[model samples]
Target: MNKPEDAPRAFQQAWNGHDMQALGDLFHADATFVNRFGRQVRGVSAIIEMHAPIHSTIYSDSTLENELISVTPIGDDAAVLHSWSRLACGPAHPAGPHVIDTLFQAVLTRRDGAWKIIALANVTLADPRTGRAMLRV
Candidate 1:
């Protein structure tokens, strides 16, 4: 499989499964993650911690759908990628099972023959009605 596409697909699977450990495993030890909330988490351990609460609460039943926009190879070992995505949130969300459009980006590097995400960022699209980010600030 193509590593560039495979990596994020695995991430999406882990997220849909609510498996924080597997999600954290996809990131490098010193990886950085920025969420739609604008908070940043550094390091895999911290990243896991950052996701635990969300996975057990608001985003508990969320699933991801991402379409790869581009994958730019930086060398045999690294690449940057972007995707158009949506988070389908279930009953736990106030709106209930609505999908939120998002833009995703990541930088991945090969370590020990496996691609690991070094940086990840998710941006929420603006609400068509209000012209402001769909996510609460």
Candidate 2:
């Protein structure tokens, strides 16, 4: 990544393309990630392993769009960022097409002059009153 803000869009683009290799390239070797479902994985290998199958299965026909929320510089080479994203499933999905809104927070660090995610977390937005996933704000 060239800038800290670029990481969120890059991540959504990778997921949309369903390319594990591309997605993995955005992270550091020891990166940590937490999915919307509360699944956590550490290390690039484990992160790829956890995500690859879903990209081929449930999320095979899913498309994602991310809107950057904020990017705060921690130093010259480190930053914390937030993004809002929506995932829309295609008709082929088993439960029928649906949309989910999520919020993501990521910590990125530049190593050897290349920016990469060191830690990330994703959470599904929900309605407190209905106890259901919120598709809109």
**What are the clashing pairs of model 1?**
none
lDDT to native, each model:
0.87, 0.93
Candidate 2 C-alpha lDDT tens digits along 1-137 = 89999997899889999999999999999999999999899999999999898888888999999999999999999999999999999876788899989999999999999999999999999989986898866
lDDT of 2 at 40: 95
Predicted structure with the largest lDDT when compared to the true one: 2
Model 1 residue 86 lDDT? 78
Candidate 2 structure, TM-score to reference:
0.95
Model 1 lDDT per residue over 1-137, tens place: 24877776887888999999999998999999999878998999999999988899989988997778899999999999998777899999777778788888999999888888999999899977987756433
Lowest-scoring 10 consecutive residues by lDDT in candidate 2? 89-98
